[model samples]
Target: MKLINLISPSANLAELTALASDDDLLLLRQDAVYLVYQAALPFPGKVLALESDINWRNITLPAHIRAITDAEWVTLSANASQNLLWS
Candidate 1:
């Protein structure tokens, strides 16, 4: 799956639009609304947003796209980092 990290205050929506493909994952957080609002792609893959983000009001996501928490992402990221480091 393709992962798009939306951690920038000024995320490029166009980048997501261009990167979106079947089975691509779009992770939204911080100021990601800048791009989430402009997402016109079908987003066949998952679109995950931070549960604590206030930007959710700016856009509408499909059922496939769900909200997650920063803690969850951190845990996942940490696990991935550990695996990479151990390897």
Candidate 2:
């Protein structure tokens, strides 16, 4: 599994699309948490946002996109075969 971390709002969409796979996990953190408001997403797989970031930004993610805690983020990172950053 791949862990794709998007740390900024200006992340390259083309690069993300080229790298993303169905088994990848997309993590929205920092300024990237604002991406949840977009109607279309670059990654088609599971999406997770930092709970703290989401709360800080007051973003309400769609049901399909989950808000994960710091521990959960660490667990995902530990379990993934590959880790990628979009920003």
Candidate 3:
């Protein structure tokens, strides 16, 4: 079965990446924005981000990482969003 992983706040990309396989679709959100700039794993899925998010302006993400708007994500559960942590 195809899996759709919604990675929001409180989720670690590294840990998720480890668990994720080439078949799994990893959806990055919130602090997970950092993953966009990093190297792409063997996982053959799309890495999406929110266009209105501040991270989109601060980070230089790879082409593979698509920056979508809030409305877009809202329309499809296929997309996910999250809040960044600050401590």
Candidate 4:
């Protein structure tokens, strides 16, 4: 599946949803971690956030979103069909 790295909260989510497929993975990092505050994510796929970023920002994430480490990020990128950066 595709692994999309979203780095900014200001990025167009509509564009993201359009680009992502149902089997894709969405990973929020940096300022994009703030997007977790939304009631629901538009993408119809798995969602993850950087664990360190979440801790640094002091934000609590919902159960649906998994918090991942830097090592896990590397693993996901290595396994994904494509790694996209949306900043």
Q: Residue-pair clashes per candidate, as listed? A: 0, 0, 0, 0
Task: Specify the poorest-scoring 10-residue window by lDDT in model 2.
Answer: 36-45
Q: Show pairs that collide, candidate 3.
A: none
For candidate 2, write residues 11-72 as lDDT tens digits. 88778878788988999999999988888786868889999999998888898899999999
Cα lDDT of model 1 by residue, 5-84, tens digit: 66664544555566566665566666664445553534555667777774455556556567777787676565442211
19-53: candidate 4 lDDT, tens digit per residue:
99999999999999999999998998899999999
Q: Give all TM-scores, in the order shown.
A: 0.51, 0.93, 0.55, 0.96
Stretches of candidate 4 exceeding 4 Å from the true structure = none
Q: Give every collision pair in model 4.
A: none
lDDT of 2: 0.89
Worst 10 residues of 3 by lDDT: 78-87
Q: Pick the candidate with the highest lDDT.
A: 4
Model 3 misplaced regions, further than 4 Å: 1-25, 54-57, 78-87
Model 3 lDDT at residue 57: 50
Evaluation by lDDT, superior candidate among 1 and 4: 4
